[model samples]
Target: MLTVDNLVKSYGGAGRGRRGGGPSEPEPDTRAVAPDGSRVFAVGGVSFTVEDGELFTLLGPSGCGKTTTLRSVAGLERPDGGTIALSERVLFDSARGINIPANRRELGMVFQSYAIWPHMTVAKNVSFPLDILPSSRRPPRDEIDRRVRRMLEVTELGAYTDRSATKLSGGQQQRLALARALVIQPEVMLLDEPLSNLDAKLRESMRFELKRLQTELGLTAIYVTHDQSEALVMSSRIAVMNEGRVEQIGTPDEIYGRPATRFVAEFIGTSNFVRGTVASVRGDTVAVDTPDGRLVCSGAGAAPAVGAEVLLSIRPEAVSLARDPHPGAVNQWAGEVLNRAFMGDAVDHVVRVGAQEIRIRSHPTESVEPGTRVHLSADPARVTLVPA
Candidate 1:
């Protein structure tokens, strides 16, 4: 297992540099500043762990510190604080002063760019790491060749062994990159948006392929990406990061279905948020009073105290719409359909409920005409409550 604890990285020295992502872009909220406005923290005390044979993803948007965290784990970037360890080995420790060199850390990394050596053959690319190893640690020539062949087979690139690395298709080159990383048989693999370079269709297909390779090889990997769908589809567990901190960590279903925070509910996918105050708590059910009406959450993980302010997150698909109210529905309200969008397989309708507008997603065939009166209802189990 690989563990990172309270890792911190700052740029331009503490208390001596300007803030923000420069003039080209807005400063990320995660780019924390010291109280005196001295230090610009890129990764502000980020932490997570990847179990053996599991692919844990650091998922967030640009400048959110996901890449920096991955780079720190690969020893490509030095952190200002915190501890990094691989199983029983101490890879880095600020307090103990035990920073391992990147090359000696025995971690494999695949970057956004495939970084394939254009002149080398597929086999050469895969074997280069072993070939350049220190003589004392290098495997015998036959052993190196065997490992290279085995990785190629595992990555489904055995037929491309003799092909020039640059001649392979984008997908094939991606496989070659994975083959090269796997050749080392490193303790952990760090992938930094490895699929971001491919076209959309290829990228989608490769997600499954990469997951297959990771599972079949029983590889421990930490994948970093800004794509929510990618993380949801490929990760064994996901750490949703924003502004340099982990917002929530859980299986894809939990993160998507029951987000721990408003940021998580908004970032993972689309969620309609309703600001409300907790009205009551009974057993597993917690009722909240919103501007529209009372919303009850039945699958609430931990109920907040009564009368506390909170945000109710209802997924677009979770809100059911009908021309007439379902008799005795738990959480139902009358509203006017403001507009709708046909999204191929699904349709999205925007309903104006008093002072608020709630979006509902439904089957394409269920599209409601604009300006029509509709009843918006949600199951108690589908509504999630987030602390305000």
Candidate 2:
């Protein structure tokens, strides 16, 4: 397992910085070191663990510090404080004064740019890392050749072994990059937006391809991306980051189905957010009063007491429109369809109820016309209450 404890990396004012820190490396405890000047923290204190053969992902928007955290683990950016370890080996320990350089970390990295060498053929590009190792550490020539060939075959680049790196298509080039990285047989792989360069369709295709490759090789990897869909599709578990901090970490389904925070609910996928005040708490269910009506939600993580303010989050797909709801449904509101769209696989409808506009998605065959009166009902099980 790979573990990170309280990792922190910051910049600006009152410190010698990553590489230039004097005798005693400074801890990243100064929140406002700049005083009058501005301080920027690319990565605030964050921690997580990657289990054996698991594909872990750091997911967030631009400037959220996801990439910074990944770089810290890769040893490309020295952290101000924290301990990073792979199994029993300590890669870095702030108190111990141990900081492994990037090259010595024995990690394979694929950046947004594949960085393929145009001059070298696919096979040569993959073999380059092993070929350049110091004589003492380098494998025999025949062994190096075997490793390169094996990687090329595993990455499905064997047919293009002698082909110039520049001659391949976007997808092929991506595979070539992976082949090169895998050739070194690093213990862990760090991928930073490795598929962002491809077009949308291609990017989606590569997500599956990468997931397959990671699973087949039983490789432990840390993937970083801003695309929520990509993270949901590829990662075994995801860490959602915002403003240099991790908001939540869980499997893709858990994060989407039960968001721990409002930001997570809003970030993971589209949902209709209804602000309400808790009216009652019965067992695991919570009833919140809104302008539209009283909403009773089950499966809400914690049952808040009556009169507490909260936000009701219900996914569009969980809500449905009907001419009339079954009698005495827990959540049912009368509304008029304001807009409708037929989205090949599903139909989307925006319904206006009292002062709230609720969006509902259902099967493509079930759509109501605009301005038509309708009823919106959501399963109590599907409604989640977020602390307001």
Candidate 3:
């Protein structure tokens, strides 16, 4: 339902030197860098489309421009260059000098901080947006009350409808904010880290609720967050951004299982990078020589030339640890346990294999202690090769 093309934003003067040599000063056409040696295009050259009723997410680390892009789409910030369209309506076109004001865009937004007025009650907060509605489009007072009451019920805040927003808990306030956004019956919802303020447990619960609400309402949503797990759980597709550019876009499974780049692989999960030299290529498998031993891995996308240096990305859970060695395995490494950490249902083992430290995950029942000899084997298909 929404599209952004060739979007770029930058801050600071290019070729200028900072007190310390940080990211090169923003170029004449580039966005300025933050004080932390990080540049902000916030949403640099990002392009993607969200299908009607689809929940799309922009995910990355802080300063990756996910939030900047969302704000730009909401007309909160002007873009350096780009076009934004919502369901064929031109919301922004830098070249055409077309920029629709935020209120006229027919979109709802939820902020990281609950932007509810402390003096307002839940019903009043939800009714605030409707005041801007054209007279013909505005609902009657009784109808507005009914809509607000129903929304509060949907968000499970019916009992608090008359209570002042300031008295509500964080989660409650968030629900109130969501009710207010949905009360407008917006075609699309722009959520900017709306759940970031909640505790871990509440955050997890709210994700499911948020997804359910979107599906029930069939609302197109552009969710921005730095949390990979949150994106994975709620989005129909994730547009992974880095340094203002969209690095990759795909379903959660695709982004996690077969990341397009090393950055995506490393950022999405606990991945182990194994430095090795390509030993040989046979059929679909590529063999590599590492400090520990020869390892065979399925070529993810590109197969490095024989003898070329490469890095293998493997998830921690993919490495299996055994006290007894397997007779015939494509990838095997013998290592001494360096340390072990118990994390609820799983045991994390740091194994020293030659000059490399490999992490392995096993069930809590497994018994391999520090100083013990252990063998690690991984499925060839689970190993992804990337240019070193």
Candidate 4:
């Protein structure tokens, strides 16, 4: 397993910058350095683990520190403080004064740009890493050739072995990059938005392709991306980052269905939020009084104390719309359809109830007309109670 504990990387101001700090320097305990200036923490106390053969993802928007954390692990960027280890081997430790060189870390990296050598053949591109190794560490020519061929075959690029790297298409080039990285047989792989450069359709397809390769090879990888669907589709578990901190870490289903915070719910996907105060707590069930009405939530993680202010998150797909009210429904509200939008396979309707507007998604053919009266009902189990 790969472990990172209390990793911190900052820049500007302070005693010494990220790379300037040494074992002799006294590190500041907090982000603030002096009365005259402060530091920008690209990664502030971020921690997570990547199990063997698992595709762990660092997901967030730009400048959220996801990439910095990945780079810290890759040894491309040095951290201010923390311990990074792979199994029993310590790659970096601020206290121990151990910082492994990037190349010596034995980790494969695929960046946003494939960085294929246009002048080299596909096979040469994969074999270049081995060919440049010091004579003491370099494998024999026959072994190098075998490894390169094996990687090409595994990446489905054996037929293009002798072809120039520039001759391949976008997807082929991506596979070539993977083949090159896999040829080294590194201890772990670090992918930093490798699919972001591809077009939408290609990017979607590559997610599955990368996941399949990682599974088949039993590769332990840390993938960084801002795309929610890509993380949900390809990761075994995801760590959601925001403002240089990890907000939550869980499986895709857990992150999507049971967001730990409002930012997670809003970032992961579309959600309708209702601000309210907890009215009652009954075991795992809770009642919240909102502007729209009283809502009951069930099967959530834990119940908050009564009278506490909270926010309720309900997914658009979790809500059901009807022309007539269904009697005995647990959480039902009568409203008028304010607008409707066709979203290809699904249609979204904005309904106004009193002073609140709720968005509900349904089948494209089930769209309701504008200004039509409708009823919105949601399963108590689908309504999530988030701490305000």
Q: For this target, which candidate reaches the highest TM-score against the unseen true structure?
A: 4
lDDT of 4 by residue, 188-226 (tens): 999999998899999889899999999999999999999
Pairs of residues at least 3 apart in sequence or in different chains that clash in candidate 1: 15-38, 15-39, 30-243
State the TM-score for model 1: 0.93
User: Per-residue alpha-carbon lDDT of model 2 for 1-388, expressed as tens digits?
Assistant: 9998777777776533332211122335454335754556666667789999999999999988888888888998887777899899899887798999988889999989999999999999999999889999999999999999898888888898899999999999999888888888988999999999999999889999999999999999999999999999999999998777788889999889888788899999998999989888888988888988888899776688889888888999999789876577889999999999999999999999998799999898898999899988889998988878
Would you give me the overall lDDT of model 4? 0.89
Ranking by lDDT: 4, 1, 2, 3
- Could you give me the TM-score of model 4 versus the true structure? 0.94
Residue-wise lDDT of candidate 3 within 1-388, one digit each (tens)? 7888777666554432222111222222232345564543455567789999899999999977788889899999888777899877999987888999998888889999978998898889988888668899898988888889889999999998889999899889998999999898888899999999999999999999999989988889999999989999999999887776777899998888767678899899888888889898877789999877888888556576898998888888999999879789878888899999999999999999888799988999985889999889999988888668
Q: What's the lDDT for all of these models?
A: 0.88, 0.86, 0.84, 0.89
Tell me each candidate's TM-score: 0.93, 0.94, 0.90, 0.94
Where is model 4 more than 4 Å wrong at Cα?
13-37
Give the lDDT of residue 115 in candidate 2: 95
* Candidate 2: residue pairs that collide: none
lDDT of 1: 0.88
Poorest 10 consecutive residues of model 3 by lDDT? 17-26
| Highest-scoring model, lDDT | 4
Which ranges of candidate 1 are over 4 A from the true structure?
A: 13-37
Q: What is model 4's C-alpha RMSD?
A: 4.0
The candidate 4 region of ten consecutive residues with least summed lDDT is 16-25
User: 9-44 in candidate 1: lDDT tens per residue?
Assistant: 887655443223322223333334555667767677
